[model samples]
Target: MAGLVDALGPILELMTWVGFVPGVPLLVWGLIIARRRCVWTRTTGEVYSAGGFTGFRWTDQDNVQRQTLVDADVARGLVAGNEVELHYDLCHPARWALGRPKHDNTVLILGWILTSVGILCTVGGFVLLLF
Candidate 1:
């Protein structure tokens, strides 16, 4: 069998660009959302389910209705009409998050680290090819 690096070289190189391109924005948004959430106002929102999917609905400060899928397991006993504390985006109140998503953050941070290392490897690989 080929060496592990040789087998995975192309994948690692491509993933570097892919993760770096999207991961940067996702990481930034995750961080910004996390920081803003620190001061999110407590609002009474209804958690609803239909067709095997669950989501939350609430009205923002501007009185605009908003809805988002709830993926964070930080809260429990989520049923219809279960009042929950939600965090809204300061810039866009319609955007919301139930609570801190550790898994998501860990993935974002890991993607960044891996992408950074991949970029270095790609540069070295290119240099080796040229030489």
Candidate 2:
């Protein structure tokens, strides 16, 4: 029992780092996505094609007409001439999102939760090791 307990310590210690590994990167990626989508301009776009590569057209703030291609999932169940709500970047009108940006995104939320767990685990592990 004593030997087994000693062996488990190192394994448990290593596990404390698990959250930080994926958590940090995911948090950073989520922040980048949020930053890029910070100033999105919302508008209605008309679907021109609902085939494999969905195509839609919208007019930007400049009043110039523009068309772009997206995945079929973005315009699912929509046919040609159907109007869809979209969000476009202010600086880069060509870049867009299917709808409003979600405030609680999976990556960001998961990353934050995991990072908090990692911090608690690491601190608890150190305290145990020291004692």
Candidate 3:
């Protein structure tokens, strides 16, 4: 019916904008988390499964053994007792280094732009509905 269609128009537009805006921040956050530097030893280690996830465990020169989860890329071609450098976050030791992830500010900027557009669309939708 024409009445139903008219009412749904603004709702659908608002929904589309709302859904699109958060994606920017989500993408940026994912990239930031992925690109953040981590620390690791210069020794290659074997892949071990723990807590339902694959990780690596190695012994440091001090004879201290350390274990951390690595990304799939690092997991491939990895062998036990092989030398590898582990990258880890200085603040968070729990997180292990995989490899250097690319860093770009474009994602962050896109997030901001999407957020602004979403806000504008939402406000406009509300104003239209009120009238």
Candidate topping TM-score: 2
Question: Each model's TM-score?
Answer: 0.41, 0.49, 0.33
Q: What are the lDDT figures for the candidates, one per model? A: 0.66, 0.78, 0.62
Clashes of 3: 16
| Top candidate, metric lDDT | 2
- What candidate 1 gets wrong by more than 4 Å, as runs, is 1-39, 72-76, 99-131
Over the stretch 1-131, how does candidate 2's per-residue lDDT look in tens digits?
66765675676566667778888888998888777655777999998864456688999889999899877566577788889898888788887888676566788888887787778778766665654
Model 2 residue 93 CA deviation in Å: 3.2
How displaced is residue 31 in candidate 3, in Å?
15
Candidate 1 per-residue lDDT, tens place, 77-127, comes to 687778787777657665566663233466457656756765776775575
TM-score of candidate 2 relative to the true fold: 0.49
Descending-lDDT candidate ranking: 2, 1, 3
Q: For candidate 3, write residues 1-131 as lDDT tens digits.
A: 66875786677587657756685666678578657745443554566766655677766556667787667766677654555566544445455555643445566666666766766666666666755
Which pairs clash (backbone N, Cα, C closer than 3 Å) in model 2? none
Stretches off by above 4 angstroms in model 2 are: 1-11, 44-58, 67-86, 91-110, 127-131
Q: Which regions of candidate 3 deviate over 4 angstroms?
A: 1-54, 58-65, 69-74, 104-107, 111-131
